[model samples]
Target: MDRGKKPTTFFANRNNKIYMDLKDIIRENTLRYLPAKSLRRCTSVCREWKLYISTPFFAHNQSNSFHDLSGFFCQSHSSQPSFISLDPIAYGVPDPSLKFLPEPVDIRCSSNGLLCCQGRTGYKAYYICNPVIQQWKKLPKPDANHGCDPALVLVFEPSLLNFVADYKLICAFQSDLDGYEFDIYSSAEGSWRTSGEICFGNRQIVPSTGVHVDGIVYWQSRSTVVAFDLTSERSTLIYSYSSGSLGKVNGKLCSASIQGSKLTIAELSNPYTNTMQMHSKTRAWSVKNVTLNDSVFAGQTDQKSVLFIGGKIVVIRLGSTLISYDTRTNDIKQLATEVDYDPRMIPYVNSLVEV
Candidate 1:
């Protein structure tokens, strides 16, 4: 080798070693701190990064404290919808069982790892089952006079009491001209019983999606959020938001959503404010607002909220597409397409079960 070109081999090896170390650090710390949106984008970069990021550690980190499972963005073609599992994060990986659900229909998520799916083709029966574990049971039509919203399903929370371990599945339907009525069914009981009718005034909007928080299913319609406590087996009004203020929160039956996590309750305005409160420790909420180009906050705001993911507040927008917001880095990115499933079809995100 010429004297002027000396030490090229040693320098090349040294640089390669440094590059390798940096890549390892990026893989480890990136999974730790990167928002799910950015992490997902990194996975799409290449195969090596995909394998590194799709590990149980990464998935577990992305998993909610309530239940970490793959949520499907599905569509229906039949009247009797069924629960089938799909790899939501995996890119085009065909799921053999996913083919069985040829007849797509509307789906609603419930507690105890159950999903309530109704068909679009006919007035057949409603199917309630867990897609992950594949343990499913069906429900025939409600009583002759009892017509409930097959889209509504009640889910039960996990109990520490070993002897009294069971989950509840509830559904809402129309019985009379009054409005909407509800029925309660328990896996322990295996029977449907009348709960009550919920009549939201014309001014109050009932969000199609009802989140179970604190042993009660909560829903936000136009302005009101209602809760139905399972222990008492009754519905109770929780909170209501005015027209200007958009109220949206997500979770199953647990305090995990409001606690210190990636999920947060933020306020965004012209100043771009964001905040999250801990419902357990304090009633107070953390607030932050920024002055950014109008285009930044231009997306859909009504279906916007911060979700708790791995102890961080991630902004989620339900629109033509699903967007997750990362507050720590002030990053906004799209996670899934709106064509997958309507956010209104299945309101809750977490699958409540030991999957």
Candidate 2:
């Protein structure tokens, strides 16, 4: 405002160097709340802005601050990957089908910003890719070929201390020593190894039913939930329940069961330290029951149709309509219609983490 003074947009100069201005400090904190796709575009605004968004600390901050539902990557054996954006403007990938990979891939598992897809071109090798940035890494073949549909789950948690993304993939394949063994791959070490822990007995585990929470990965079998701890490298039979959708809520593992309009959300006590939880059949308490009093849920009685997309409750009803129920404000919005029902609608989180 004054000719004699510089505007507040610049810094209060000292020691022959200009420090960050008040305006930039506010913007730096604010930009962390934006999605990775938005932040990547903002990097080209200017050199200072590029430097601000390029920092590992900034990426970590943004990941920590905003992990809400972005969208879903719906895929099946019949079709390529299709993105169903819950918020089109705020969250999406550059390529929904992920054509940027070396070859067409089957979307196996997704965690945080990374996707673990098995390539169709070469030996059906596994690939870890970040669709937001179009970066991918082909993993060396595991010690065990998990057949056609392995119970594969990717584990990734953004660390405040580290910015470089690291992940692990666990394949629950059949073992000769009775039942199942985990063929694990670690990105940090860049190698695959098999764990000694064997899940004994015949368990019908589905690949689409696998989910990673905290450090443990759980898969829904025909009648029980089998868990494998990444730290302990052991597999245990955790919670035994009927066929339902397994998901996480507010950092705790929960399962969702839908019978017509009556939706039951059960919060399972996943005690990692207590081995007793594995042996004993502990019940999952129903934390909440939501009734969708509308035609959207008319006769769809599939118990395993709920998906945790961000903080919202997303339900794919009968393969025709996609319903999103707001858990916070009690707002109901139909995200999409005429959608094909692919049992596995992978919840996608757009992030800047490299492959």
Candidate 3:
């Protein structure tokens, strides 16, 4: 080898325009798939990276790729809340128990990266917080009494230009009849507003069964599936005679429940389809029934919580075990053993979203 000159190595192309373009393209695409924590740290890598990561479009893209279930905030009246992560690296929050707040809270509902919690003290005010960033916002209490078991649903849809997520919290206040009315709190307005729509004359909305998908929030009872559209501000019965739990599976509204040894997972096929066609000749759901190998199940299956771990995975409590059942593969795996019986588990997505 000639000692006078050095050979061009792999990084010698670093100065080339085409090489730089390729590197930028790869970096941008790779950044979109990283976990939110890594993306938060990536902002400090460089000013350009920082600007890109902070963009709303980038947040939307990253959110689409990072929709995996981090874990759940298991809430109970007897004990303090707990975080149960399926994978610590992917689903862990900075403070799982939400100790950063001023007071102890009951984790009511969660959407995207935010949580709706009711304070255990002083009029039981509501709070919305991002546990990953340890930021929270206290909401003004509504005029309606939510009662002991309030029906609360948090709705958040991250748009391409929506970096600071504008969320809506729907709380069902009881009507004079057996029905319930909703008080929707908008984060953008920093206030609560009552909606005219009422889940009227129906059984009380099951607070734990609430799940938001698309722009609609769903709560299923033994007789029907009740929904409130965030855009239209209307409550509609989506499904009927559905004794199941509501969750989002594979990016669609799904209902999962265990009956005896058989597991039924129903997907809400089309809510926007022609309503006349839906009510008359067709059903809005496409369902799948999976039979389990074991018959052992937790007590009070009717009231037990059903949570979706991620894509095609349903987590339910069996005795003291938290088991995740894969609907696609019919595989069952134990997530947490010796869990609280019939724990009120609210699914949490660990993200860098701010309150």
- What are the runs in model 1 whose C-alpha is more than 4 Å off? 1-66, 69-103, 144-151, 159-165, 174-180, 196-207, 242-319, 327-331, 337-355
Best by the TM-score measure: 2
Candidate 1 structure quality by residue, lDDT tens digits, 1-355:
4667645558888999999999888776655444343455687877988987666545444332334333333333333332222234432212213233434445655443345655445565555654533445556555534333342546655544432325565655544655555677666766767765564344333434555555656554454444566677665443332222222234322111222223433331211111234443422223434332234345435444322221122334444554544445656655555433333333223332332
Query: In lDDT terms, which candidate is top?
Result: 2
Error of 3 at 206 (Å): 1.3
Q: Candidate 2 residues 1-355, lDDT tens each?
A: 4679855653435522433465476566788888987877787877888898888677678776777668888876868998888778778888999999888888988888788999877579999998887889999987686988889999888777766777888899988887988998988999999988899988889778788777889898887788899999887876554467787777767777666677777777645434445666544544578887766566656443665433456454555666777766656677766665564678878777766
Candidate models: Cα lDDT each = 0.45, 0.76, 0.75
- List candidate 3 stretches off by more than 4 Å: 1-26, 37-65, 270-281, 293-310
Q: 176 in model 2: Cα distance from truth in Å?
A: 1.9
For each candidate, what TM-score against the reference?
Answer: 0.52, 0.85, 0.81
Local accuracy of candidate 3 as per-residue lDDT tens digits, 125-189: 88888887687888887887888778888988776676677888887778876787788888899
Candidate 3, TM-score vs. the true structure? 0.81
List the candidates ranked by TM-score, beginning with the highest: 2, 3, 1
- Count of backbone clashes, every candidate in sequence: 33, 1, 0
Which residue segments of model 2 deviate by more than 4 Å?
1-20, 40-47, 54-57, 270-284, 298-304, 307-310, 341-343
Model 2 deviation from the true structure expressed as Cα RMSD, one decimal place? 5.0
Candidate 2's TM-score: 0.85
